[model samples]
Target: MSSINTNKKNTITWLLLLLFTVISVYIGEVLELFTTQKSLFIGAVLFIVFLKGQQIIDVFMELKYAPKLWRRLLLGYVILLPIIIGIIYLV
Candidate 1:
């Protein structure tokens, strides 16, 4: 059924995201590969985690079915909010 296939796809995406999360954490923490590097690497990894989390929220959390404006607002809150705050703090 269509719903069944959709569920499978969602599951796979989540698994992939989980795998990436583990890799990112391991590389950033256990190996300490990111500590000495620019914030770029850690930021990128965290950004990927955020993106995956957003996708999961959109799909499994049913945010995707919302109105376009609401979705954009939600994404802005999730993505841009931190950057704005960080910049403010830095300044």
Candidate 2:
């Protein structure tokens, strides 16, 4: 019974995450279409997107329950990825 409930909860969480992601994408696209100049709304939208990304990464990667070594490795990759991309772009 507990396992069944757990499954249901996880399913709901996933569905909510999907819905939020879709809504965020649509909002960002609409904002882009109507706005020519940057605004505060742009910042808000970016923050929401980043928050959603963190949620997805935490859930999908199971980082919340992972070992210390695994968590550190994941963090290292996350930290290095942006730097690597920036260097590549610069080159």
Q: Could you tell me how far off, in angstroms, the CA of residue 69 lies in candidate 1 after the best superposition?
A: 1.6
What would the TM-scores of all predictions be? 0.69, 0.53
Q: Model 1, residue 71: what's the lDDT?
A: 79
- Per-residue accuracy of model 2 over 1-91 as CA lDDT, tens digit each: 3878857756876887788778778877887788764453455455555555555556666675778787667666655665565445445
Which one wins on TM-score? Answer: 1
List ranges where model 1 is wrong by over 4 Å: 30-35, 84-91
Error of 1 at 82 (Å): 3.8
- The local lDDT score (0 to 100) that residue 21 gets in candidate 2 is 74
Looking at model 1, which ten-residue stretch has the lowest summed lDDT?
A: 30-39
> Whole-model Cα lDDT per candidate?
0.71, 0.63
Error of 1 at 54 (Å): 2.2
CA-only RMSD, every prediction:
3.1, 4.7
